[model samples]
Target: MLRTLFSLVISAAVLAGAYVYTFGVPGSVAAYFGPQQAADSSAGAAPSGRGGGGQFGGRGGGRSTTVVLSPIEIQPYQDVLRAIGTATALRSTNVMAEVSGEVTAVNLEANQMVAAGDILIELEARNEALNLEIAEAELAYARETVARYEQLQTNGNSTVTGVALSEARLALSLAEAKAGLARVSLDNRTIRAPIAGRLGLSSMDVGDSLANGSLIVTIDNAEALIVEFELPERAIGILQPQQVVRAMTPTFVGRVFEGRVTSFDSRVDPVTRSVTVRARIENPDGLLWSGMTFSVELSQASAPLAMVASTAITWSQSGASIWIDNDGAALAVPVTILYRQDESVWLEVDLPEGTLVVTEGAQKLRDGAPITSADAPRGRNSAGDAAAPNARRDTAPRAGAPT
Candidate 1:
């Protein structure tokens, strides 16, 4: 009986092997060949195969889970504004020759600092002095002739015409003397500085002849430096005279100079829509020179805020922006900034209380780009946010909490 049972068992095993070989895989031919089938099997299993499939996939030990992805949830982030600014001297001037003369000597050298009324250059005046002496002699002779004519008239010995002629002669001599005096002054050809400033390189040398109104050399008031910049006409609302400003300059690296808005242009630039603005900075050491180029940054009005975003997202032209996730999609939104702190920006775009914004990858998406929810940051937008749809907006992640 035992022998018979063994033989029967061996026959059954051989039959089963032959059946498997002929059919390849019994009820799992599709499972071996199809990826969907493999994934379905994994999804159906619990995270660690501990239990049956659940609504949420478990962690480490839990089996795989099936998730239906929707759209990415991004948090709002601060925006940093950037601009390029130019620099200028606090005081500047285009000095010109005040009198006509040949440049005899240049007292102040180019690029040297000088005081007010400092003798800058001189001209030859020997001829003028001689002419003044001759005028003095002529004037004395005229007065003596007038006295002699008066004596003759009083005695009734001189004719009326004779007396008149004598008077005319005296007047003519007096006028000649006055002309000589003026000519004498024309030779006082020492050029004096009009204002205290740094002298620029002179275009004239010792022998260079200069006419009145000729350009002598430029002088700039480097006692302090002034910077002029252009602002948008729209800024008419916020700027005030003497408003303080701070900037970084090439000459003063990492150092901030205190400045004030001194003035602004009356009209706006039609093309650039910018109006001129002037800021003056103190320079007692005379370190800041004229014609120096510097970069600057300014704000019309500023304050403190909770968050900010990219200006590019603002979309319309200026102001703030928001990414409205309407109908489970990402959309850009614009807002006005409340204030700017440090390099980060701040805005208040009255959102509907609790709504997620698409802060990053703004260029990658349109108004309604599909997003997925995986693990996202709270209160900040960035790439690689959650994409698979799982949580509801009403139950969105809180600030400083993991998404």
Candidate 2:
């Protein structure tokens, strides 16, 4: 009986395999088991019909990305070279004492605007005045002696050599008197401004003993400021005197100071390979000061070129590019940047005039991918209005289309 049971079990297994092969698993299972178990088995299998395609569907199904576009147009763009520089006074000097003496007066105030020949300081000159008086007395005595000598010579009371000697002595005394007067004038005790400018802080005050060449004050002609900067030696070919320049400083943001290139170094620095350039800027309001840092920009002549918003340019492993909207499809166009300004970038590309280029939402695009214009009206695609119910129902059969 056990042998018979084992043979029967083997036969049953073979029959089950034959049934599965002939009618398929679900059909064979329905034939063997009740319909309820077959239904459960079918439910556990991969979904069928409308729901078979899962979340995003198989390959080749993605929603079109929305983007904003701007048309490429020709614009006049100026090529600019930028550099950092320092603002300096047009003329600056250290006011020093020509002769040493006690400081008797301070005639200048800190930050005072002075004119040329204006007295800035004074020193005691009483001794020089006394010396001048003594020399004048000596000169007067010499003239009297010369007159007496001539009278004696005319009256034959003295020899001609003696009279000639007296005349020579008198001439020497007159020269000494003139020298004394000049010395007194030289020691006039007043220090005057050599140039018209604004004065810095005075180094010596009243009663301060000053030595010769001691610094009295500093003066700067700030009305016309100079901005000095360095540029590559190659720029020497383009640089010229009286070229326009614009400069900006942190102290005056958004305010551009206009200037002209006044001079450049005769030789380029061997170590830096750069040449020094100086530009003269007007400072009528005296807003600019010496030693202040500035951002200098020198621009060449303007040229017509294709310009786009800087945001529109994108970079990838393939270098710089931009997305062009070609009939509701994104086309990546390679570009070469020629120049960049604050908000615009000039590019050299093969795109035609008025070609629409994506500015916003560009990163979500790929080559030949369908795109929807962000600037389109609400609930509308790039083509036109929203699709009708029948059209959406028709598209449902396609992969990735929402049911």
Candidate 3:
């Protein structure tokens, strides 16, 4: 019986804790439906308000409407940060064999840098040399036959059929000679770099027997590097090209590799809902390599704009809004948000001069409430140092005071 009672008590305690987390605490109240402040304003010493539903409009001499002005500054509407990227080699190729034979020469080694057309292999060519010499002799004989055919035809001393036969024999000899030359050329089996790049570990040893198209080594163009990374699909439309980005590898911690966005995938993957982006960067000093893993951070802010507002001053509902002193009442001033950063919303609105926006008593009052600024807190309610144009609104007492 005691165990059962203890279990009940523990369960009740847990339920109470969850209630506090979901609803509100008894003394200190908070709600997510509203309450925002401009981030750019200097830190406010105190900003406290009650938690409740609906637009709060206060009607009392307890608080007076004051035109609190947010200090003007530029803030960027960032594209919710993106994946990191790094500089990498742009082009890389694996050297392969076109012919086969015993290795007679090895011009490059593992880790050696090579240029285009640089020979890196050789196959023994004793048979090929003999074939080339035979081709030259055949070519000479073919030329002599052609000359004789022409001479006979000019002298009109040979039948037309005889001259034609000689011509056919010459053609055959020429064709044979060309075939021989091709065979000889293929015998050398020299492999050269197709591009200027760094050579990587070769699977070939000095005596490695390679067939045609067999990979000899890998070459990577290190003059420039490109990296690809994935980001959330929602981030695709807002991302901009040439945005500065940085990356780092575990092996090279604390030293960032700089890069920029070169392109982004046109569409998001259906299964993953992520977009892939490519970045190109200079890989000077041959530091970046292919297939190396890296962590990257891509900046999403398009550009800083003048007249951005502190995000905290804005409240959210089905859309977003702000508060201001309207006529004799605390007005729920709806605003268009340029961006939302943490607790602040970078926003913009067109308003006449001397418009008083409520930075305090927002949760306790509504749009038509008669407000008394006497109990309003000192300083701007954005948890900032935004000074109101009127001294009365700026110096009002804080929240939790007698109305």
lDDT of 2 by residue, 196-228 (tens): 999898767899998988888899999988999
Q: Write the per-residue lDDT of candidate 1 for residues 58-120, one digit (tens) a residue.
A: 221112111122222223442222234555555566767767877788876878888888888
When sorted by TM-score, best at the front, the candidate numbers are: 3, 2, 1
Per-residue alpha-carbon lDDT of candidate 3 for residues 1-403, written as tens digits (9 for 90 to 100)? 9999999999999987665443233222323221221111112212213221222222331223333333335556665564654445799887778887778778767778888999888887787777777777777777777777777778886565675866767686776768677665864466778898888887565776778777788888877778888888777666788877777777777988877778988888999889988877677787777777778776566565433335326455646666655444555666676766665555566664435555544555555544434434654332233332212222344356676
* Model 3, residue 188: C-alpha shift (Å): 4.8
Q: After superposition, how far is residue 67 of candidate 2 from its true place, in Å?
A: 9.7
Alpha-carbon lDDT of model 2: 0.75
- By TM-score, the best candidate is 3
Give the winner by lDDT: 2 or 3. Answer: 2
Candidate 2 residue pairs in clash (backbone atoms < 3 Å): none
Query: Lowest summed lDDT over 10 consecutive residues: which window, candidate 2?
Result: 47-56
